[model samples]
Every structure is written in structure tokens, then in C-alpha cells.
Target: MRARKTTMLALTAGALTAGLAAGVAAPATATTSVLVKPGKARPGQNVTLQVPECETDGFATSDAFAGSAALDGAEEVEGRAGLATIGAHTPPGTYQILAHCGDVNAVGQIVVLPGTAPSPRPTPHGAADAGFGGGAGGVNVVLLGAGGVLLAGAAVARSRRRDDVTA
Candidate 1:
């Protein structure tokens, strides 16, 4: 009985080693993450850029994201890849970023038009009322219109004369 017990213990140990040799252990899974640099943000505004982790679709966050440094509460892309970034209200112009993995590029654009200036009320014949210049353009326009009308009338008279001759 003692020999049988020892043999059982050795068999158990050999079986465990053989199981490991046969690759029954879990495979090594590596997690790869890319570092995303936040793009240009407004002075008083906030921003966030998602940092993508390793995924089957190449490299990038599952969903586009953005945030300030230390992306704890910011948007995160996990278990995904080949996605764009997310951001809003960032400065007033084009913004660009170099993606770490060169898989997806991040970019942004903002146009900050200057605030409207209080326009002065226009007065007819006054300095502020001089729309796109002075009376020069107005006279030119009137002369052109008169010339066109005269030309059209002359054309109609000539057509009538031709008709009369034909008749």
C-alpha cells in the first residue's frame, strides 16, 4: 500500500508536467497602448484625446476621444482599433497631431471670426452712406442702362424696317 501511494504521487507529478509541456497553459497575451498628444486647445477651454490600446484593427482607440493630460476620467478606447479622435471647441484654426502608431492621424479645425463691431447707422449722401464708393459708379450704371435701352429700341426699329421691305 505504501509503494502504491508513492507511485500515485509520482504519476500525478508527471501528469502535471506533461500537461504543461503539451501547452495547456494559457498563452501570453501582450497589451499594447499608444500615447496620444492632446491638440491645441483654447486658453480657457477644455480638451481631451483618447489614448488607444492594442487591438485587432491595428492601433487606435475603439472610439475617438479627447481630454486633458492624465486621461483618467477622459474618453478611453479599449478593445478596439483604427478609430479617429474626438474633441470640440479647440482654439481658432487648424490643429494637427502625429499618431504614435502611424495608423490613424488626428486633426482639427476651428474658425474664430472676430466679434461684430457696432456698425454706424447710414445717412443718405453722408460719409457713412457712401456704399461702395461715390456717385461715379451710380452715373456709370445709369449711362449703361440708357445705352442698353436705346440699343434695343434701335434694333426693334431696324427689324421693323426689314419687315416692311420684305412686305
Candidate 2:
């Protein structure tokens, strides 16, 4: 009985050690470089990007766009690849697509066709008529009031707790 118990404990310890070592020895898998297909595209077109070490939650960007380019399938292909849509408003130029997976970054370039048409601009409206002036001001006032109340409540609770401890 004693020998059997000892053997079981040893096996458990060995298994646990192996598990811990595996957890520590493994490195984070992240994309080292981005590979874009065709290397050139017109506006409002889709491009496939491959990130060999990326996870499903990666992002892609372009300098030509105002912000991050629209990305699809970031969580697909076991996290190694995704599809990026070229913005229609992106002007004709040579731009780099920046891909980010965790702490790793990859970059690829694409040339935009000059003949592609630009996106249309939206019509402007007055501040009040556009639901920006009065409505936004009221929301700000309500948020400020709620924040003040929370701060005041926290101060009161802290003071009461301090007084109780002193007593």
C-alpha cells in the first residue's frame, strides 16, 4: 500500500511539473510580417492579408485612411489571416497597411489607382438642427451631476468608516 501511494504521488508531481514548464516555456504567437495579395488595388475593393503568427484579434491600418482600415476575418483562419477592405475615400497613393497582433507588428504596401472615384461628402447642418448643441449640453450636465453625486457618496462613506474605526 505504501509503495503504491508513493508511486501515485510521484506521478502527480511529475505531471504537474511538466504542465508548469510547458506553460512557461511557450512564447506568444504573433505576426512578424504582413503579406498582401496583388500588392495593388482600386478603392472599395477587398484584399487578403496573411499574418503567420497572429491571433484572431488583430487589426490593420493604412496611412491614407483617417483611421484603421475596415478589417474582416480578423478572428478567422485560426488567427493567422484576415481580409482588409480598402476604403473608398482613400486617395490615390502608395500606402502601407499596418497589421498588429498583440505586441507584434507587420507592414505591407498597396498602390491605389488614380482613376478610382472619391467618396461623396455628407451635407452639413446647423449645430442645433444637427442634434449637437442643446441635446449634447443636457447630456453633459446630467453626466456631471451623476459624477458629483458619486464622488460625494464615496467621501461620505470613507468618513463614516474612519469615524467608526476611531470610535
Best by lDDT: 2
* Tens digit per residue, CA lDDT, model 1, 1-167: 99999999999999999989877565544433333333433333333334343223332222123432232221245533232334332334544433232233333332222232234477666345555556434456786799899999999999999999999
Lowest lDDT 10-residue stretch of candidate 2:
70-79
Clashing pairs in 1: 47-67, 48-66, 48-67, 49-66, 49-67, 50-65
lDDT of 2 by residue, 1-167 (tens): 99999999999999999999997887654436677776787777766777665644567887654456433354444445656667768788898778876656777787877656346578866455456456534567777799899999999999999999999
> In angstroms, how far off is 85's CA in candidate 1?
2.4
Candidate of highest TM-score? 2
lDDT score, candidate 2, position 165: 100
TM-score of 1: 0.22
> Model 2: how far is 167 from its true place, Å?
99
Q: State the number of backbone clashes in model 2.
A: 0
In model 2, residue pairs whose N, Cα or C atoms come closer than 3 Å (at least 3 residues apart or on different chains), thus clashing, are none
